[model samples]
Target: MTLSRRQLLQAASGLALTIGIMGLPALAQAAETVDIDELMKPSPLGDKVLGSEDAPVTIVEYASMTCGHCAHFDEVTFPELKSRYIETGKVRYIFREYPLNQPAYAMSMLARCMPADKYFDGVEIMFEQLRSGALSGTFLPALTKLSKQIGFTQESFEECLTNQKLLDALEAEKTRATNEFGVKATPTFFINGEKHSGALSIEEMGKIIDEKM
Candidate 1:
């Protein structure tokens, strides 16, 4: 379902508690395996790649900002992956938006609004805020705090969330992921064209990356 700006803000107002208590494993279990070919289809919305183009392995992630499991991976697992793979240029990591709810859609749009170099920074901040229970209260106040830290003023914050074009683009991308790539849940990973779901441990992710190399 497409979420308008007001609806998304309303969703964000109550999202913190829902995401805080959500079961990550249950979210993982909701996803079904898809063919590697289908999982590896070119992203319709382009990509936000981190690492060298020539990296031997490519990792694509479809994640929702409001998903508890996605937050766990971002907070716990991603640093190691970034250091060992993304930083060393062993893997090219691409993160795609797959908002599961209206709040998630709003957060994704905000991330896109940041300068290209700050996009991932915006995402990490959102995840951190989610983990810290910052979005539990009024959505605008929490978001405004983050926006100020990232150079976004009140005007820009409102404008970004209300950008209909960006919202539609994110919706289209999410639709392609669900309909074409069989992505049923957040934190779904496609490593070297193989689909996996869940908050995979560093060792588990490393093994797969090593095998690809």
Candidate 2:
């Protein structure tokens, strides 16, 4: 992956995490805006919410649909976490788009096309397509199929994709990541305000979640 300036900064932050240290808490306490400019960007889709609004544990994953590691995590890891934590009201798993390529962008757009209630399910379906290598030029076609399964029409799909407001919202998400969140890669995770880069194993994630619990 081509590293951007923001990514380099995140690498430094990750190192701090490795050492069991972070400045975010102190910065928040001081009422200083976190160096992460990404948080300020307004999302057109609002926040991709899962679990309850008041859930104690919030797991936010910034993932690209074209990322194989992300697909793996979605397919293998996320389900278990959802079952054990999110389903039981112990956690809320929120997925935010982090498109790294054109395909990923399309996939993100497709996921957003679903009704708010089905948004995350749409995300899972999109990632499944990506994992199957069917998310290529077949994005719209695949979305059409999934949409049909969920009782959406082709017209609705087209309308959703062509929605300028949604496009602007997604663009805003990308800009926010670059400017505020210091996001530089796909499959980055922020668990309870602590950020993690790269796709970590479920066990590794569980260790952190266990501690938080």
Show the colliding residue pairs in model 2: 36-180, 37-179, 37-180, 38-176, 38-180, 38-181
Tell me the lDDT of candidate 1. 0.80
What does candidate 2's lDDT look like per residue over 1-213, in tens digits? 333324332332222111111111111111122332344233657778668767677777777766777877878888888888888888877788877654455557667766788887777776676567553443445545655765567787556555656556676777776566676677777777677766667787787788887
Q: TM-scores, in order shown?
A: 0.87, 0.73
Q: Considering summed lDDT, which 10 consecutive residues are worst modelled in model 2?
A: 17-26
Q: Find the 10 residues in a row with the least total lDDT in model 1.
A: 22-31
lDDT comparing candidate 2 with the true structure: 0.63
Report the C-alpha displacement of residue 177, candidate 2, in angstroms: 1.7
Residue-level lDDT for 160 in candidate 2: 55
lDDT of 1 at 212: 82
Model 2 spans with C-alpha error above 4 angstroms = 1-42, 137-152
Error of 1 at 57 (Å): 0.8
